[model samples]
Target: MNLFARCYCRTYQKVFLLARRFLDFSEPDLLEREGALKEDLPATLKMTGLDHFFLVISKFLFDKGVHLEMEKALKERGIVLTIYSDVDAEPTFDLIEKGVSLYKESGSQGLIAIGGGSAMDTMKAIGARIANPKKSLPKLGGVLKVTHMPPLMVAIPTTAGTGSEVTVAAVVVDKANHDKFSINDPKLIPDIAVLDGSLLASLPKSLIAQTGMDALTHAIESYIGHSGTKKTKKDALTAMKLIHEHLPSFYKDAKNVEARDAMLKASYLAGLSFTKAYVGYVHALAHAMGGFYGTSHGWTNAVLLPYVLKAFGKSAYKKLAEISDHLALTGKEANPQTKAAAVIAWIEELNETFGIEKNFAGILKKEDIPALAKHAEKEGNPLYPVPKEMNAKELEKILEETMG
Candidate 1:
């Protein structure tokens, strides 16, 4: 057998082995709040973020049943809760400052972050700022800059994407500079991650689609990135399989609790994968594009995923082939390249089914292409072990291709 054939055989065996182990394996200390919002809100709230916590949330969640239930429960427990629901998608530094001010003013002893990546990220930023009051936000960029850990920070993901609940990094936009930055530190990771399906039950289908795709991007990019380890790859593979099988169902029926639960689990697994393995061009560019255009972060990620995978090509063939196999996108007889291409085609088809746009024409500016490309490059280098290192010219072409 040739190199391709050997990889095929190995992947085939590994798939079965992983399937058995993946189902049996347990994650470290997760708070599964399936009916916690309805049945045990006070206990759940206290268990996760502790009493007197600040809830950094989105307007959607704030208006929804989850926050209401939480408020009622916490109030019953004599737990004074402070809510800051002014969080915007792809949150800016100004937003972070606003949250910080609220957190301090509220005199909350703990933190509870609800909603998607933006909410969680904003909460994380607030926690970081409180812990490192002397350091500016910009000074906290890059890896492990957090000297103080936030008090009892808990993350409850309303959307099954971004995996911000488990990740050690938070992406905060500098809207003034028309760019984005990250706060990377192990301390930034939430003390607890509460996966509550009730929180996601009323999520809009568009949000479900966007956030699901973001989780998919996280799993795919982590699996294919050069930094992937044996453990991370296993998590990524399990996450991809779960996401591929369940995201569509969850998207179609927002009330499908089973599907929502699975997707949320997948999101958590993907978060674990990417936090350790790291993401690639998809995230790098999505961050820049989102910052510059104020586009939806997950939508940009959904649009750019296939293009970035295509760029990875042979460099990520083995991993892509494995993903294709897990998703049943290709036959065992297929070569690695063929399997990889099939995965890409499947992704494109998936996007089409969900009505995601392939082009970024409305979102991209031709003149901003250079800046976006350079920004992506700055983010991709050193931090992310992308399969391919994209230079400015190459990235510009990508931006141009994405342009309408």
Candidate 2:
């Protein structure tokens, strides 16, 4: 088979897996098992009392008949369905503006977001602006900046990465500023989410590995981040175990529906964990790298994971020990302070196994360090708890080490 044929065949496999997952969607009596699904889908979602939902998803994730099934499902509930199928990476302001305008024109009362982070962010932004037309997109940031949002928002992540489906924060790149600003409003949280592992079986192998790493980082960083609470810790520990057991296989055999299913489930759990606990400096650094160079979010995260952990590994040893044990990288006599070295080594090994070049200078320039460091600190400093307390010079050292 030609390259295109090989790719198409894999996509076909992914679709078949998705169809099977649909069959398993929920024997959950929505009433009796609401708590169980809440782990997969949150219960904190506030319904805005909207009549219909507009789906915002990437073109790639739109299948031949998925929309028809969704529409049929909504219609049974008296909800109309409209779709805006153009969400892309690093969502620009124009995209959000366009989606919001379309939602208003279609009179869409709520949003259903599918695909990855970009689509979810766009849908959340549209829902926010649709309910409050007066505020400019740039005007809303920080806590509770937007008070009102559309009645219902459902986020279903096709990729097992990004955790954008459940998180209260929405990120968009301000191209002018060359930075990503997050809108951290409780109202931005989606009311419903569907994590179907079948949706992930067709993802490109490179993406499968990269996004899987992103989910792993979410689980780890949340466990050690500033906002981590008892609840977030519990969720994150479980998320870590799930990923540790499944991510390797998912990467090795992308066609393994069982591995794909576990990955999707792990991603959902990680998303929920991070949504409450928030992320730490690894994400802080990755976000800055993405804004400055337009680097791929997951690939960038994969590259930075070890170095960022190394930077703060001393202070974070206690948490790292737990992860190391979960990953089975430990010696009897090794203290967590020391055993964490094994953890870092294993992460580097995984990155190498996944074909992510951790040593290369990824979309970064030495000259850009001062600006990037400042922006990273500005953007992520608020939420990261286990800070290594880095300055521009220190950040330059980190970039220098990572580049090597």
Q: How accurate is candidate 2 locally (lDDT)?
A: 0.72
Error of 2 at 28 (Å): 15
Cα error of candidate 2 at position 364, Å:
1.8
Q: What lDDT score is found at residue 64 in candidate 1?
A: 62
User: For model 2, how does the per-residue alpha-carbon lDDT over 44-84 read when each residue is reduced to its tens digit?
Assistant: 22234456668887876664444555565556556676888
Best by lDDT: 1
Index of the highest-TM-score prediction: 1
lDDT of 1 by residue, 53-122 (tens): 8888888767664577667767887787788888757677788888888788878898888888888998
Q: Each model's TM-score, in the order given?
A: 0.89, 0.84
lDDT of 2 at 284: 75
Q: Where's the lowest-lDDT run of ten residues in candidate 2? A: 25-34
How high is the CA lDDT of each candidate model? 0.81, 0.72
Residue 380 of model 2 has an lDDT of: 53
State how far residue 87 of model 1 sits from its true place (Å).
1.8
Task: Give the range of the ten consecutive residues with the poorest summed lDDT in model 1.
Answer: 19-28
